[model samples]
Target: MTMNEANTYDRYQRQIILPDFGVGRQQKLMRAKVLVIGAGGLGCPVLQYLAAAGIGTIGIADDDLVSLSNLHRQVLFTVHDIGLNKAERALAVLEQLNPEIQYIAYPKRLTVENAFEIIGDYDMVVDGTDNFSSRYLINDACVLMKKPLVFGAVSRFEGQVTVFNYRDDAHDEPVNYRDLFPSPPRAGEISNCAEAGVLGVVPGILGVMMANEVIKGITGMGTLLNGRLLTYNACNNQVYELALQVNRDARVSMPADKKEFMEMDYDCLCGVGDKGFEIDYKTFSELVRAGDIAVIDVREAGEVPAFDKFDVVNIPLHQLSRELSQIQAGIVVTVCQSGQRSLVAAGELASAFGNSKKIYSLKGGVLQWPLLHKKELS
Candidate 1:
């Protein structure tokens, strides 16, 4: 046997010995190209396994930096990687794990303008992102490119997996993500791992499962997850599979052309942008100390420990229009648990009082307040 063949045999002997996967399956894996978005929790396992499986070209797309909190779930990184770009750090570590594979690191956020270009080069895309904006964007882009997407999401103790835009041999029609979630959820209506707290193993399990789908897609090893949604509950180790059908209405939401898709505002669609003026916690803290602006907590009354220092008013978002008289100040700031509700409140206040009155939403809200205080202390 040739030296290269002998080396390849030594590398994948166990997998090669399997009746279903042999030299041909390994060759298919070696020729496959997959792009994984988000180098956080789910991305770690997906990258590790795909690299070890010898995917010919793997792309890592993420604009975020590693933080202290990510160490628990983002296994590809370490304490030393904190503050570094996730994609670059992930590339560095994966290369050490398997130098035979080719890795591309995109140290920038995926935007509509760039999504098509980057994703067009890959055979399939993996959705490891945690947010709706990124998820929808990747899904729409895959549909536009006619590429398959392996999607996985984790929340607290529950995780979900599905394959979108994939054509199965049994079905002539391909199923895309839009068929599952026709529209994005309203901002603050749903909380992420950062807000709700996810079990460390949830993303790990979901990510590995997502990687398996990708392998199946590349090698045609097993039944693909097309048209099926797999949901797993780590708390009880129970799993559920729901059959998904294409939605004509959902298909209409996709951008008609490349130009339109490129110009689509995913953030706005997801209710994740500043509709009104926004102020950082540091600046809001300064305003609070100076007693220049009134702080209005828009969260429901029973939400949390009340704000003690600044004479803040607890006006739930629903009552803001009726209780406008309670807030006497011309300049006001609206705040919520995580800054999302506050944005909505700020917009309402701005619209009600007109442009003459200044309104600002506390960016990052009460959740970020303590972090800012800690930074000040440090």
Candidate 2:
């Protein structure tokens, strides 16, 4: 036998010994290419095991920076990695763990402009992103690209895993994420890890399950979660499987062509509103220091770590509609916990007072405000 073959056998000996998954499956894994959409929670474990299993090429995509809070779930990053780009940090660790595989880090958020191009390069895509906008965008892109997708998500004490766009041999048509979730949930209707808080082990479990689906897609080792969704409850260790059906309306939501897809307003469509009047924390800070814009905090009365500057007014989102007359400033901007509700509030304001007042939504809200201010301190 060749020296390379001998080395590979030794490396994956444990998995290779499995009756159905021997040298053939190992080689398939070594030839597969997979792209994971986020380097946080779910992506961490997915990237780790896929690389360890010798996936030939793996892509990591994320634009967010590592924060102290992400350490609990994002196992790939260290405390020293705080402020570093998540995709790059994850790539560095995975490369160290398995130098044999090709690791590419796209340190940018996946947008319509880049999603198609980036996803096209991979054999399959894995959805580990937290928000519905990104999740829907990835799912649509994968469907358009005709790429298989290994999907997983975690919230609070529960997680779900499934494989989408898998063409079952027994079936005439393929199933995708849209088949399961026909439309993106209304913004703020579902809580993300940041808002709801997931147990650290939850993503670890779901992520490993996602990795298994990817391996199955590559090596055809077992039945992929093509037409099924598996839900796991960490609190009770209970597992449930639900069969999925093809949704005709779901496919209709996808863009008809690449140009249309690139021009799609995913954020607004998913109910997070638009970036048209969104202001970044840094720019908003500058405006605040200059002192003219109306800074409306749309969080509830008791939200912590309050902002004391910018002549901020406290009006919860639920009350913003009735309290519009209370705001005295001309250029109004809304802020919320993590930006979603604020965007919704901004949209409402725009609809109510179209050209009469300039409206803007804080891009990353209170969660990102401190980070932006810290940069000024530095």
Residue 85, model 2: lDDT of 99
Cα-based lDDT for every prediction: 0.86, 0.85
Give per-residue lDDT, candidate 2, residue 22.
Answer: 87
RMSD of each: 6.7, 6.8
lDDT of the structure predicted as candidate 2: 0.85
Q: Against the hidden reference, what TM-scores do the models get?
A: 0.79, 0.76
The local lDDT score (0 to 100) that residue 365 gets in candidate 2 is 80
Q: How close is candidate 1 to the true structure, as a TM-score?
A: 0.79
Best by TM-score: 1
What is candidate 2's lDDT per residue for 19-130, written digit by digit as tens?
A: 9998888888887789999999999999999999889899999999999999998999999999999999999898889887799999999999999889989999999998
What candidate 2 gets wrong by more than 4 Å, as runs, is 1-5, 274-378
